[model samples]
Target: MIEIRRSDERGHANHGWLDSYHSFSFADYYDPEHMHFGPLRVINEDRIAGGQGFGTHGHRDMEIVTYVLDGALAHRDSMGNGSTIRHGDVQRMSAGTGVMHSEFNASEHEPVHLLQIWVLPQRAGDQPGYEEKRFDDADKRGRLRIVASPDGRDGSVTIHSDASIYAALIDGAEQAALPLQAGRRAYVHVARGALTVNGEALAAGDAAMIVDAAAVTLEQGRDAEVLVFDLGALNG
Candidate 1:
């Protein structure tokens, strides 16, 4: 089954300094039907104003992944990790037990656009951890590159979850495909530009939830950059 979720169908919130779209129920944007997909709990596309961002916050039993798309993002965590991540960089924080963190735009003049994802851990109460890696455009051009996974395979950051995240950059005549195993599911999100996923057209902010499918294919893209989540079967 393939279900297309339009860009405008997501829950939106704007707080002057921040504009965000939630792919699943989050904060004040509640949707019983869109609570989650498998272990993938949250996918928030956010744009933060220059020099403004989220203050110290707390999270537990969740694997948080940050992907910067446009500008830079400064991050500080209870794990004593502090750094700035720009485009093509992926940051993963396992808030096992508990953790405090803050994120702000690294630039005073340029807004930062990014995607914040939360995945449920395979087992709760594990030790907290952090990891960051960079996947240059050349690494993903015309192909899917694993960015985050349970095993950290292919130079991808490790996540304490039963899911794998893939990134791709494709243009005209370029394509990529990911084969799905039985009982596995896939969620494809277009970060920017336009593309065709498994024959379904998608634009920036749009997503395709797939289940019981053989594979996910991307083609006929127009400067498209996308993220794909290979997830386990839905949990009750």
Candidate 2:
């Protein structure tokens, strides 16, 4: 089955310096019907203005992944991990026991656009860890690039959960396909441009949830970037 999360249906928050869209129930946006999906807890599309950012905050027992689409994000955490993430960069932080961190735009003029994802960890209090990698356009063009997985396969960042995240940059009639395991589900998020998933078109900020699906397909309609999540069981 396939369900669409229309861009307009997402929760919107515009604070002058920060404009964000929440795919699922988050912060002050509460929609019981759109609370979450499987083990995928949150998907927030954020655009921070120049010289602005999220203040220091805390999280625990969640697989937090950050995907930068434009500009640069400076990250600092209680674990002493600090870095500047930019376009083509992916960062994963497992807030097992607990972790405090902050992310701010590293640019003085350009806004930082990114997707912040949270996946429920399989085990609690496992241990906190962090990893980041750069996956360029050439790597994702016409294909679904596995940017994060449980084992860090193919050099992708490792997450302590039964989930995998794939990214694709499609254009010029190019396409990609991802085989779905039986009993598993997938979530496709369109970051920019337009594309068709299994023949259904998706625009920027739109998302499609697939469960009991045989496979996920991406066919280019125009230049676009997409993110796919293969997730396991959900809380019952």
Estimate the TM-score for candidate 1.
Answer: 0.99
The reply for model 1, stretches above 4 Å from the true place, is none
Q: Rate the local accuracy (lDDT) of all candidates.
A: 0.96, 0.93
| C-alpha TM-scores of all predictions | 0.99, 0.98
TM-score of model 2 vs. true structure: 0.98
lDDT string, candidate 1, 1-236, tens digits = 99999999999999999999999999999999999999999999999999999999999999999999999999999999999999999999999999999999999989999999999999999999999999999999999999999999989999988899999998999989999999999999999999999999999999999999999999999999999999996574
Error of 1 at 106 (Å): 0.8
Task: Give per-residue CA lDDT, model 2, range 1-236, as digits (tens).
Answer: 99988899999999899999999999899999887788888999999999999899999999999999999999999999999999899999999999999999999899999999999888899889999999989999999999999999999999988899999998868989999999999999999999999889899999999989999999965889999999887873
**Which stretches of candidate 2 lie above 4 Å from their native place?**
none
lDDT of 2 at 148: 96
